[model samples]
Target: MLGSQTQTPPKEASSSITDKTKIKARYFMIWRWHFYAGLYVIPFILMLSITGLVMLFDDEIEMITYQDELVVMPEAMTLPVSIQLDKVQTMYPHGTVTQFIPSKAIDRANKFDVRLADGRSVLVTINQYTGDILGEIDRSDSWYQLANDIHGTLLLGQWGDYLIEIAASLSILLIGTGLYLWWPRDHASIAGFLKLRFSNTRLFMRDLHANFAALFSIVLLLFLLSGLAWTSVWGGKLVQAWNTFPVYYTWGDKPESHLTHADLNHGSEKELPWNLEQSVLPESNQHIHGAYTSSETDKGYVATQNNINIDSIVKQARGLGFTQYKLFLPQSEKGVYTLAANSMGGDITDPRLDKTTHIDQYTGDVLVDVTWDDYTVLAKLMAAGISLHQGDVSVFNKALNAVFCLVFVLISLSGMLMWWIRRPSGKTRIGIPPHFESEGLWKAGIAGLFVVAVCFPLASVALVLFGLADWLMFKPRR
Candidate 1:
């Protein structure tokens, strides 16, 4: 295809990708930033991937290990829920039942959470058909729970929370820059664009790093955003507070709760949606009125006389088409019964199925019923993204999540291997990409980052730390 007459060359060659030495300007800038982020993000991403893989199969693992508690012989007719409560009371006589998980399947057992007099909590399993006590377990000690705690707080509380936030912030840089590096070069062949093409280990590592990231970019980005939505600062203070479902009632009065969802959360993992976390727990007010109805209380409650039966509640939920739901018992006299289902808890992973309702303890009136349709725009995104990130949507989703986890680990390790292979021999220096001495662009990029810092203070703080580290250790000699 060579022409007899000389012609003006394309601004950049198509094969520039094969030679990193030929990369310049914005591409090189992106590569350098991506390199810097990988140094910090790899360890955390690795930890998350490993823990996430286990968490994806939390139900399966717990089922095998807790078959006695979770599985029971199917029966023609299960015993009434009250009879099962009596059995649970026998195991922990002094325990106050705070929550009840009714069996979702025919051969499964119901779980009751008891808060003991000594301030300890245990989950007592009850066989619905025979009303036999299966076994009790400390709520926080399970293998999957341990993985969840590590995934959330790294078992270090606030300090670990901050470290995770920084990792997530840097991953934004990593993913964004990785997309830039993975962009199809001018005149790139379809094979070169999509398939791995490498004669050397160096090319193999780079290709794996870029192509895999490119393939899973959308999933990785969603995981980062949804996971970050649980972080203390960015998620809790800034976004979650504003987007919470606004509690509305026909009655003119605003309400307050004796407790929030945080009080009932399972260890470090969030048990409720971002919207419900901020809402006040509703109380049964004597002045409020609804259609004539009865109410109920546990056996030990002060107003136990003519207590509303739990079967009635379950029947009502079933009537509403709730395939699965969690029930939280009222602690005190004024407390309301809370029944909730959302993507956050893996019951009907679609956000449109998100539903939470509080029934007045005394009146049996619906105090609040917040549905998925009530969530804010961003809250809706978080709900769907969280379900996808957690691999709870469907069978296909879980398989996809596992695959993504494998690709995620491959991307991180391959990039690390590439750096190892490219580093100069006998040099203590990490091979940071060379700084571009371009006109205006470098300064412009810094100004843009300053704007980003202004918007995301945590990311800005991370940038400063990375900049200081570079000045001390990675900066080239004069």
Candidate 2:
């Protein structure tokens, strides 16, 4: 017995009472932090949610509401691109023509983009054949523009933008903490996981909140991430880091290469016999300035001759089987005339816009031609994503985005309800307790300092006041 007297298997040790108390205290602290923070963020969340939903179907709404104005003709005799530009210049003589959009739809004519000397860009739609001004679409009237303003700044400008950024950062933290709280202690029991009983009002509301949140958590996260990517400086850097491939411009010659007449093919067009010595570059010069002159006395820029009449161009482009066409006039001496076309409605896969031709401003010869099929894989993917996001691709995507917007609105409402229910009732609840009444004064002070350090520098001053209050009350109970 003595030999075996090995201390009766020392009673298995159990978790200490102190350990249990500490754990309880820690959980309470986290709960209190969440309650306070959630209460503060509810209003902002609601605003963001409502605005986001409205923006989701903006493209569809615009199309439906402004059908007559947005639509265009596929083929119509039009003035040359240069002449159209000249008309725009005269209309806004003090401004310069920036770009042109050719028509692909039968209802629309042509559009010219002009930049005033003051630096404001204006859109001017013109009749392709007669060069008659049709209408002007100002950015101020754009619903998408308004949505972006509200989504990014709550219409408050830079200060609002900063505040939203802070709110978004807090939202991420809130979501993480919320998920942690939702996790069950016992993995085997699914009792609370899928429960949605509506017998009790409070419980039913809780279930509704939790279930819907869980269902769309991933999508919400994606929206938040993409939005943050566009708002934050660091987020922009991250995007740039991921997009490392250089974007190439095939229409222009690189510094290391010299493109000559021999390097280019005229296709079906015959080269006119002209003085090569006068038109070609010097042996010592690497740059080429190709311009066609109809007469010695009539001096005009090379681009003037190459500019296609918008009305005639549209008719010819339609003959090529294009249902829609968009023309972009050059911005500078070296720029080329760009034409793009697409079908009536949007189709991501074959939405039909193509940068099919780039004509020389001087010779009126096609300088470059590329179809939709010729786009790089990344470019195509980007176009598709944009179309989907804008609700321009398919009805299905539009419906899905519409639902997403509604979900955002619901989320905001739920957040507001939760906050309204938990607002503190008294002044005492508004401030941290003094040291004499609460041992947590020091801890609270530390927390205040930490929050200020991370959130706003101005908060640091408030934190100092909190520390002073704690010192005055506690002073180490001697």
Candidate 2 lDDT, 208-239, residue by residue in tens: 56556667767666555545544433233334
TM-score of each model, paired residue for residue: 0.87, 0.62
| Model 1 Cα lDDT, one tens digit per residue, 92-120 | 76678877787778888888888777666
Q: What is the lDDT of residue 306 in candidate 1?
A: 31
User: What TM-score would you give candidate 1 relative to the actual structure?
Assistant: 0.87
Q: Model 2, 111: alpha-carbon shift in Å? A: 2.7
Give each model's whole-structure lDDT: 0.76, 0.50
Residue 45 CA displacement from its true place in model 1, Å = 1.0
| Candidate 2: regions farther than 4 A off | 1-44, 60-68, 71-87, 117-119, 129-131, 156-159, 186-192, 197-201, 241-287, 290-302, 305-328, 334-387, 424-478
Number of clashes recorded per candidate: 1, 33
lDDT of 2: 0.50
Which pairs in model 1 have colliding backbones? 296-308
